[model samples]
Target: MGRIIAIANQKGGVGKTTTAINLSACLAEAGKKVLTIDLDPQGNTTSGLGIDKDELENTVYELMLDECSIKESMKKTDIENLTIIPANVNLAGAEIELLDVKEKEYVLKNSVDYIQDDFDFIIIDCPPSLNMLTINSMTTANTILVPIQCEYYALEGLSQLMHTIHLVQERLNPNLEMEGVVFTMYDARTNLSTQVVENVKNNLDTTIYQTIIPRNIRLAEAPSHGLPITLYDSKSAGAESYRDLAREVINRKDV
Candidate 1:
């Protein structure tokens, strides 16, 4: 079975979607079958891989709401071994609609359970909030990959995120574990970036991946062109960093 990982952070502009898109592409480049689930309503992950939202009939929303099967929602991306469960703006309503439903928190988990063995990795791009959708992503994932931006408030809101993870571990998914905290949008020339990295390393219990994703124009521009960094500019620094990230993730000790 594939390892189900949720790329999550409550704070926006943390490079969550960028990490999701590029890492999946790199993993597929290494010959691993990767399935990316775009759980965020923004649909950035969907468009990042060249999926048009207007052309979709079913999406992660339908799968989570149990209106459609997960297999039915899967779509091939431009990358050979990478597939995506695209999300659209309609997912914004899922949080409220799923609230009154039975096993509301496990909706995503249950939906993914049937198709766990289909890929080598299932990476979920979670919404930038600690809402029911994020909870569902946590419950569905075996491990959570947090992408922390190297900024002054890098650790801000992390306590709340950890608390939610603890609650989920205690009462929902006992097998759930933190994969690691990845440093994203790093500027090597800045002292503040160094300070944030030092603080994060000193505090977090999880392993910090050696590959730090530097802030690059290519990384930011790739999504606009509906492509991963690897496809957008294979020779770029952004592409190399994501490839290294994919290698680190694949080599890490499984929980």
Candidate 2:
């Protein structure tokens, strides 16, 4: 069965979507079949993989409403082993539409039921806020991975996000686990970044990946060009860090 991992953080601009796009791409580059679901209505993951969100015929929104089969929504990305179930602004209304559905929280989980074994890994990019969409993702995910930015307010809102995860584990998905934390936007020149890392280590009782993603211009530029760092500039530091992170992610799971 494919391991379902949700890349989530209520805090924005922390490289949540960036990690989702690149990590999935790197995993595919490692010869693993990967399916990435864009749960965020913004659909950055979809576009990051070179899919035009506006032209999509089917999206996660349709899957949530039972308007289309999971296979029907899965679109091939430019990356060889990477597939995506794109989303759009239409998905913003899915929560309200799903209100009438029975056990709506499992909508995504149930949708993935038939396709669970089709890939080695299923990556989900969740919205920046905790809402029905996020709840649906957590219910489906085996683990939640948080991307914390190396900044002054790095620790802020994390407790609440953890609390929400705890509640989800308690009430909805007992088997759900924290996939631990990955630090993003690290600037080696700044002591503040290192301090934030140390502070988070001291405060949060979770596994912290040793692979730190640095603040790279190429990383920021790739998304705008609709290419992952790996494809846009494989030689860049951003691409190297994500590749390292991907190896770490897979090796950790192996152990």
Candidate 3:
């Protein structure tokens, strides 16, 4: 079965989508069959992989609603060994639509179970909120990977997110686990960034990857161009760092 890793953080603007795109791409480049699932209604991950979300005939919205099968919703991306199930603005209403559904938390988990054997990994880009969508993602995932930006207030909402994870483990999925936390947009020249990293390491008691993603212009630019850092600027520091993170993820026994 494929390992489902949900790239999540209730706090927005923390490199969640960026990590989702590059990490999935680099893992595919390393010869693993990967599937990227866009659960965020913004469709950033869909467009980031160079797929136009609006133009899609089927999306994650339809799959979650049982309007279509998983195979019908899957879209092949530009990267080899990588495929994606895109999401668009229509998914914004999923929270309300799923409110009264029976077994609501397991909706996504049950959908993904049928396709688990077809890929090596499934990376879900969760919405940046502790809403039903995020709950569904956590309930479905085997592991959760959090990306913390190296800035002030980086740990602000982490306590709530961790608490939510604890609830999911106790009430929903007993097998759910945390993959690890990785720092992003790190500026080595700033003392604040250094402090944030040290504080997180000391307090979290979790695995923090050694590779820190620098605030690279290329990393920011790639999304607008609808390409991952690896395909847009493979020589850039951002690309190299994500590649290293991929190796770290692959080697980790818990992952």
Candidate 4:
């Protein structure tokens, strides 16, 4: 079965979507069949991969609320071997609607079950909240990839996130595991960034990924252009770092 990894952090601006988009692109470029599931209502992942959100007929919203099959919602992207289950604004209501529904926690997990064996990886870009949407993402995921910004408050909301993960492991998906933590927007020129890195390493049990994504204009520009950094500026530091992250993920999985 394919590994389902939820790129999650209850904190925004932590490079969650950036890691999801670029890493999925690099994995596809490396000849791995990858599927990206946009669980965030913001639809940033959908647009980042070059999929027009307004034009999407079926999305993760439909799959979750309307009981639509994940297969029908899957859209092929510009990158070969990369597919996406786009998320639109409609998903914003799922949080409230799923609250009292029976077996609501497993909706996303059940949707992905049918296609679990079709790809090497399923990366879900979770919403930046500990709401129902995030719970669904957690329930469906086999591992969680956390992206921590190299800043002062980077570790502030982490305790709450870990507590939620523990709850999910105990009540939802016991097999769920932590993949690793990635430091993003790292600036070596700043002592604070270096200190944040050491702090995260000293606190978390998970290994820190070696590939630290530097703050790059190219990475920020690619999202507005609706393209992954790999396709927009392959030679940029942002693109190369994501490619390295992909390799590191593969290598660690092999071990």
Candidate 5:
């Protein structure tokens, strides 16, 4: 079975979507069949893979509403082994629509269950809130990959996220675990970044990936060009860090 990992962070601007896009691309580059599902209504992950969100026929919205089969919604990306279930603004209303469905939280899990074995890994990019969409992602995922930016307030809202995860583990998916925590937007020149890293290591019980994503211009620029850093500028530090992170993830026994 493919390991379903949700790239989530309740805090926005934490590099959650960036990690979701690049990590999956890097994993595909490593010869693993990877599928990324954009659970965020913003559809940034969909566009980051070079797919036009406005041009999509079938999206994650239709899949969630039982309007289309999962296979019909899957879009092959420019990357060889990477595929995506694109999402759009239409998905923003799925939460309200799902309220009337039976086993509403598991709708996503049930929808994608049959297709799990086709990929080596399935990564989900969750919204910045702990809403119904995020719950569905957590319920379906085997583990969650958290991307924390190197900042003073990094640990501010983490407790609530952990509480949500604890609730999911207790009532929804008992097998759910934290895949790993990754530090993003690190500035080596700043002592604050170093302090944030030390603080995170001291505070969290989860394993942290050693490869730190620096504050690279290429990383921020790649998304605007509708491409992953690997495709946009492979030699950049952003691409190198994500590739290293992929290797670490592949080697992890816990993943």
Candidate 6:
């Protein structure tokens, strides 16, 4: 079975989608078959991966509502081994619509179950909220990867995130686990960044990746150009850090 990891943080602008796009791309570059699902209605992941989310006819919204098959929603990215099930603004309404569906929490898990065997890893980009879409993703995923920015208020809302995860494990998906935490937007010259890392390390009992994604213009620019950092600027620090993070993700062994 493939590992299903959801790149999630209830807080937005914390590099959640950035990690989702880059990590999946890097893993695919390493010759692993990877599938990414854009559960966020904003569809940044879809556009970040070079897909035209606005033009898509089939998306996760359709899949969630049983209007389309998973295969029908899957789209190939510029990256060879990476496939994505794109989503668009239409998915924004899924929250209210899901209330009427039977076994709604399992819709994502059930769709993913049939196709999990075809890939080595499945990555999900969740909306930056604790909504029904996130609930579906938590139920579908084997683990959750959180990205924390190295700035003030870094540790805020984390307790709630952890508590939500705990509830998911207890009530919805008992097999779910924390994949790890990754620090993003780090600046070596700033003591505040260093202090934030130390603060989180001292407080949280979770695995933290060593590769810190420094704030790079290349990373920010790549999404606008419809490419991943690896393709847009392979030699840049952002690309290298994501590659290192991918290796770490594949090598990590749970204790």
Q: CA shift at 141, candidate 4, in angstroms?
A: 0.6
How would you encode candidate 2's per-residue C-alpha lDDT over 1-255 as one tens digit per residue?
Answer: 899999989999999999999999999999999999999999999999999999988999999999999999999998999999999999999989998999999999999989989999999999999999999999999999999999999999999999999999999999899898999999999999999999999999988999999999999999999999999999999999999999988887532
Q: Ten consecutive residues with minimal summed lDDT in candidate 1?
A: 246-255
Q: What clash count goes with each model?
A: 0, 0, 0, 0, 0, 0
Number of residue pairs clashing in candidate 1, backbone atoms closer than 3 angstroms, sequence gap of 3 or more or interchain: 0
Cα lDDT tens digits, model 3, 61-176, are 99888899999999999899999999999999999999889999999889899999999989999999999899999998999999999999999999999999999999999899
User: In model 5, what is the error at residue 251, expressed in angstroms?
Assistant: 0.8
TM-scores of the models, in the given order?
0.98, 0.99, 0.99, 0.98, 0.99, 0.99
Give the alpha-carbon lDDT of every model.
0.93, 0.95, 0.94, 0.92, 0.95, 0.94
Clash-forming residue pairs, model 4:
none
The residue-by-residue lDDT of candidate 6 on 8-107, one tens digit each, is: 8999999999999999999999999999999999999999999999898899999999999999989999899999999999999999999989999999
Taking all chains together, the TM-score of candidate 5 against the true structure is 0.99
Off by over 4 Å in 6: none
- Model 2 alpha-carbon miss at residue 18, Å: 0.3
Model 1: residues with Cα > 4 Å off, grouped in runs: none
Q: Per-residue lDDT of 106-130 in model 5, one digit per residue for the tens? A: 9899988999999999999999999
Give residue 199's error in model 1 in angstroms: 1.0
Candidate 6: minimum summed lDDT over ten consecutive residues — where? 246-255
Quick one: how many clashes does candidate 6 have?
Answer: 0
